[model samples]
Target: MRQGTLCLLFSLLLLTPRVQAEEAAPSGKTAPFSLSAGSQISELQQQLKESERQRDELSKQLQTASNEHETALLGRLRQENQRLKLQLKEARATATPRLLTDQQQWFVIGGGVTLLAALCGILASGGHRKRRQWLN
Candidate 1:
């Protein structure tokens, strides 16, 4: 009896399909098996290439946009610089030029005062020193 049961199990196993049923069964019905691994891989590769091309296009657009923005900013800065330069030139043209600046004038006045003080000291001292009798 055991030998007969083992033979029956072996025959059952051999006769059954090796492939497992798909997870998404519908109304107690098993889905048909179709193998298209190569086609699916090719489709995924094509999608990857298309995405890469789109990324490259977006990156190029970003670069052009940044370059344009920088150019506009540079032009604006240059115009502002030119305007400031013109203002400076006009100020220099309109202002009065001086032979002696304030600092130089103050220095000259200080020197004159020093000379007058020296002359006054010389006159007040009577221009000579008397010898002391204690030294002899």
Candidate 2:
């Protein structure tokens, strides 16, 4: 009978739940309180979505600025190319006759030197033949 009473008391103690209500309770006396995982996850997901949208907007702005800069640079280069081509054409038209005159002068000088060398060779040979005749 005593053993049966001890066993009944032990089972009652083991089956009883621990008193955690004090730990879970909020300090503020007036307001009811709760902890929820779902609400925190919802808030975090909203913040992530907002950050992703901001990043997308910044990327679009950067791309647009880069395209505008490239277009402006191309326009400047084309204008410079056209200006250089016009200058080159004008220089060629003005300088052609001067270049031809310089070439003609060099040709005339070369021809005069060649003629003088031939004349000198003929006179030397004639003098050599006359000397041979006098000796014979």
Candidate 3:
């Protein structure tokens, strides 16, 4: 029974994944499985390096494209701002000058000036009376 179980296990192992080892040292002897495994590891490392290089290049290209897109947007915004400014300037230039046909503004200014003059005259006359009282 033990021999039968051993045979079954060996067959199972044979059915599993395996690498064919190369011959070593010019003799008919097969190389160790470790040699095959080590070669596979090296190949995997090389592939990983290649994939990383490709990823870096793609990232660089994406960054450059995005930068160009941003620059174009900025340029458009600047042009729009300049156009709006020019429109504003033209509107102001072509604007009609306000004529104060109503006398209300002039009346307000004249009244303020007249009140100021009256206050100054009153203060000047009051100062002279105060000097006379002090002398008395």
- In candidate 3, stretches whose alpha carbon ends up further than 4 angstroms from where it belongs are 1-33, 95-131
What would the TM-scores of all predictions be?
Answer: 0.55, 0.47, 0.45
Task: Write the residue-wise lDDT of candidate 2 on 1-136 in tens digits.
Answer: 6999999998878766554333554666645334566677788999999999999999999999999999999999999999999999999889755544778989988999999999999987875555456667
lDDT of 1 by residue, 60-136 (tens): 99999999999999999999999999999999999999899999999999999999999999999888998878999
Ranking of candidates on lDDT, top first: 1, 3, 2
Better of 1 and 2 by TM-score: 1
TM-score, cand. 2: 0.47
State, as a TM-score between 0 and 1, how close model 3 is to the true structure: 0.45
Which candidate achieves the best lDDT against the true structure? 1
Query: Candidate 2: lDDT of 79?
Result: 100
lDDT of 1 at 11: 86
Off by over 4 Å in 1: 1-40, 101-110, 123-136
